[model samples]
Target: MWRLKTHMLVHTNEFNYSCGYCPYRSRSRSSLQIHERTHTGDRPYQCVQCHATFSSASNLASHRRSHLPPVFSCDVCQRGFKFKQSLL
Candidate 1:
């Protein structure tokens, strides 16, 4: 007698990666790593100018732009921006 191998279908939305420290779950490994930073208070990304740290790289980049002088100024709100596209 031979045994047949079968596969079961699982929903993609299922929470596979769960946080060991807290009540959190993520579908992907990368998302779990970012979520874990909240509980662990880990800042892998750091700013060069101010020595400030952030959990995400994008947040650190946005913070660095603040130190630069604004080239484009808004006429209505009087908000200064480094890039012109932001005004639009």
Candidate 2:
């Protein structure tokens, strides 16, 4: 199964792909593929408000927060952020 293969890869410490510019390593080929985009200046995610781009979906999600209202407010200062998870 896919889970077994993924676990095997973790145990093997196989880093078949490496970053050319830096010493970044990854166990999965997909992670290496996405990391390579960073060196190549390939940003697939775009922000509509500022027309900014990011290489990963997680980055894009974080960027989108600026456009939306803050979900969590500081207890003392009342400072707001779009993500409640960031409060931790």
The TM-score values for the models, in the order shown, are 0.66, 0.71
Q: After superposition, how far is residue 22 of candidate 1 from its true place, in Å?
A: 1.5
RMSD of each predicted structure: 8.9, 2.6
Give the number of the best model, judged by lDDT: 2
Off by over 4 Å in 2: 20-23, 84-88
| Cα RMSD for predicted model 1 | 8.9
Candidate 1 per-residue C-alpha lDDT over 1-88 given as tens digits, one digit per residue, 9 for 90 to 100: 1122111213445777899889898766777898899889999998888899998887888888888999799999999898788999
- Give one digit per residue, the lDDT tens place, for model 2 in 7-80: 89877868877877789988877788789997899999899899999998889988888888888998988888
The TM-score obtained by model 1 is: 0.66
The lDDT per prediction is 0.81, 0.86
Residue 72's C-alpha lDDT in candidate 2? 95
Best by TM-score: 2
Residue pairs with backbone atoms closer than 3 Å in model 1 (clashes): none
| Residue-level error in angstroms, candidate 1, position 85 | 11
